[model samples]
Target: MAKQFPEISPALQEFILRQRVFFTASAATTGRVNVSPRGTDMLRVLGPNAVVYLDLTGSGNETAAHLRATGRLTVMFCAFEGAPMILRLYGAGRVLRRGGPDYARLLATEYGGTEPLGARQMVLLDIDLVQTSCGFGVPLFDHAGERPTLARWAEAKEKQEGLEAYRRQKNTRSIDGLPTGLFEEDPVPVG
Candidate 1:
């Protein structure tokens, strides 16, 4: 069975909170589509129609670059432990650079002004569609806890070249050569 909703219902929000991982999909008008697995407790549901995730430094900045080229983004969550359900949120998303207005507001209100290590930017999605489907075929798995590898890497990198420099070197462009807007935006250090 499948269902669609105009906004995120309370039940859906609870389901989202319970999940330890989610996937993000994005693409420009041309080139390869990007789908990436994300975790690390960086996402927040602000309201029925809005959600945001802290974008950490990674091998590539495809999502930000794709969002800059095209506002469309999709986030998906699946029930791997409990009920058999899959959720998808479709929306127009935008990148909130480190010093941007939306980023500042969200950081203060939702994040308590604490920016984690390796945080490059924030992606805010104004959701327009919410869909849920049966995940009966999906295999069940136990939660093994989040990995500390990324945090440790970020700490070491911050101690070395600094996150900003790393972002400049690796996160400025998508694999298909689209600008991620990181270079154009002047990001101030978050205290």
Candidate 2:
């Protein structure tokens, strides 16, 4: 049976922490709906009603753009190893750009001041609803390991065109023409 909660319960938080992979979904008022699989040790549950993830640089920045346009976001996690369960968090999201106070504080306090090579921004979700369901139809898979390709690419790119330059070139706009707010001079407000 599926269940829902107003906020993330303790058990749900533990489940989120154990997962190695999660998926994010968002969409602007128009255009395509974006759903992306995300990995790496970059997500954190700040409280019962809040979660944050370090969004690495990618070929596209749909989530950031979608949040900027609409503020609606959902994050889903499925158990791939043990129990058959799926958890989804529904919320409003905001991007915390690099150099912003919230970004800096989270980097310092939650992440030991270590920023990943291709980190573009942090996405904060003020969760409104938490839901769980039996994931019996989902196939289970064993964890192989983290791939080093993205990290290597980020390092090389930083040495060449530079990560900031690359962001300007590719990540500033979504495929559907929405601004990603990546390079705005003003800091994004966070709550």
Candidate 3:
């Protein structure tokens, strides 16, 4: 059976805290939808209705662009080790870049430290609905611990020159040519 809750409860938050990975899905008015697997200690639950996750620099910035275009976002989490549950959060999302107004605030409030080296922005979701279902079909697997490859890669990038040069080259647009707002309000060059 499935259940819908008005807001995330403490128990639900605990479950989220236990999760090592989650998926973020979003799309714009036109173009392919983006579903990204996110991990590491970047996600944080802020109060009952809002959740914020630090977005690291990646090959593409589809999520930021999608949110900028549509504001629709869905987050999904499945219990793979302990319980048999799948949780979905439906919400409106916003992208706050590294130097944006709320960016530092969230880093101080939710993260309690300086912005990480590879952190490009913060994706904040104002959750509207929470749904949970029995994940009977989800396979169970033991937790193997977090992978350090991404951090190592990002550190290497930072050491090279920083994200600006890389963002200019790779993250400026989605595969479908949708603008990702990577340069804030800079002009989108024709590639």
Candidate 4:
């Protein structure tokens, strides 16, 4: 049976911390829903009702664009090598860019004052619902190691031109013509 709670409990937090990967979903008011797989030790549980994850530079800025249009977001984690279970966090989230105060504060607090190579922005999820379900059908899989290609690419690009230049070319707009708020001089305010 699936169970839902108001917020994450201590036990639930433990499970969340151990997950090797998670998926984030978001959608604009009318466009397609974007679901992206995210991994790396890039997430942190801030409180019983809040969590944050470091979002690296990606091909599409769908999540940030979607959140700018609609605050709805869902983060899901499934056990591939553990007790059979699935966890979902439903929340409203905001994107904080690298230059923002909230981003700096959170980074310092949770991440020990250093940023990742392709650090883009941090997505904060103010979770309102935590759900757990039996994952009896979720196939088991073994863990591999993290991929270094992204970091290598980001490093090479930064060394060649600059991070801002790449962001301007690739990260400025979502596929749906929505602004990503990346590299913006005066970014659009979050609604």
Candidate 5:
């Protein structure tokens, strides 16, 4: 059976915290929808109805562009190891750049205790709906270690060229030419 909630319940929060992977989906008002898998230690629950994730540098900035264009987002997490369940958070989100006030506050609150990673942006979601479905068909899999490539790349680029160049060259416009923040000065890069 499926269930719905107005916000992330306590049980849902526990499940979310235990999950090692999740997926994010977004789209502009017209262009193709993007669904991307996310993992690592980059996700955080901010409140019962809010969450944030560090957006690492990637080949495309579809999520950021889509949010800028439509502000709609969906984050889904499937239980592949424990119970058979899938949780989906439907919400609107905003992007925070490295130097912005929100960015500085979030970074200080969430990760300032540790050395900074070369995270380019942060996607802060204000969840409006929480839905769960029986994921009976989801396959169980053994947990593997995290991939070190992205962190390595980001670390290597830290204080170097930065991700701005990459964002400018590859993330300036969505596939549909939606006006993303890429062209603006100190534009926020998407994950």
Candidate 6:
């Protein structure tokens, strides 16, 4: 059986907290849809109706572009090790770049003293609905180590000229030619 809720329930929150990876999906009014697998300790649950995830610099900025164009976002998590449940959060999101007021406020209020890890953007999702389904077929997998390559790259860049150069080189636009904030005259870091 499937269940739906107006907001995240306590049990759902507990399940979300245990997930090591989640998938984000978004699309514009037309054209291609984008689905991304995200990890690396960058997600947080702000409340029953709000969630935030750090968006790192990548080759394509599809999520940001899609959100900017349509504001629709979906985050999905499946239990791969423990319980047999699948959860999805349906909502709209806004991109908060680093140095922006929203970014500063989220950092201060939600993240506290954590340093930005060269993230190019933060997607603040205002969840409107929560849905759960029985993940009876989701296979269980053993835990493996987190990949350090991304953090290492970010750290090295931070030690060098900083994230701005990297963002300029890699985060300029989505593959579909959608505009991303990377090429802005005054780009803000978002991680």
Clashing residue pair totals per candidate (backbone < 3 A): 0, 0, 0, 0, 0, 1
Q: Which ten residues in a row have the lowest lDDT in candidate 6?
A: 182-191
lDDT of each: 0.90, 0.93, 0.87, 0.89, 0.83, 0.84
lDDT (Cα, tens digit) per residue for candidate 6, span 143-189: 78798888888888889988777777667767787777644473543
Segments of candidate 6 deviating more than 4 angstroms: 159-162, 183-191
Q: Which is the winner by TM-score between candidate 1 and candidate 6?
A: 1
Whichever of 1 and 5 has more TM-score, that candidate is 1
lDDT of 2 by residue, 49-144 (tens): 999999999999999999988999999999998999999999999999887899999999889999989999999999999999999999999999
Question: lDDT order of candidates, best first?
Answer: 2, 1, 4, 3, 6, 5
Report each candidate's C-alpha RMSD, comma-separated, in the order given.
4.0, 2.0, 3.1, 1.3, 3.3, 3.5
Tens digit of lDDT per residue, candidate 4, span 107-180? 99999999988899999999999999999999999988888898998899899987777877878777888887
Worst 10 residues of 4 by lDDT: 182-191
Better of 4 and 6 by TM-score: 4
Answer with 3 or 5, whichever has the higher lDDT.
Answer: 3
Measured on C-alpha atoms, candidate 3 has an lDDT of: 0.87
Q: Model 3, 1-191: lDDT tens per residue?
A: 99999899999999999888899999999999999999838999988898999998899999987887788999999999887999988999988878877998889888886787788889999999999999999999888788888789888887898767888888877888877787667543342
Candidate 6 local accuracy as lDDT?
0.84
Give candidate 5's error at residue 35 in angstroms.
0.3
Q: TM-score of every model?
A: 0.94, 0.96, 0.93, 0.95, 0.90, 0.90
TM-score of 5: 0.90
The clash number for model 1 is 0
Error of 2 at 144 (Å): 0.3
Clashing pairs in 1: none
lDDT of 1 by residue, 5-122 (tens): 9999999999999999999999999999999999828999999999999988898999988887879999999999988999999999988988778889999998999988888899
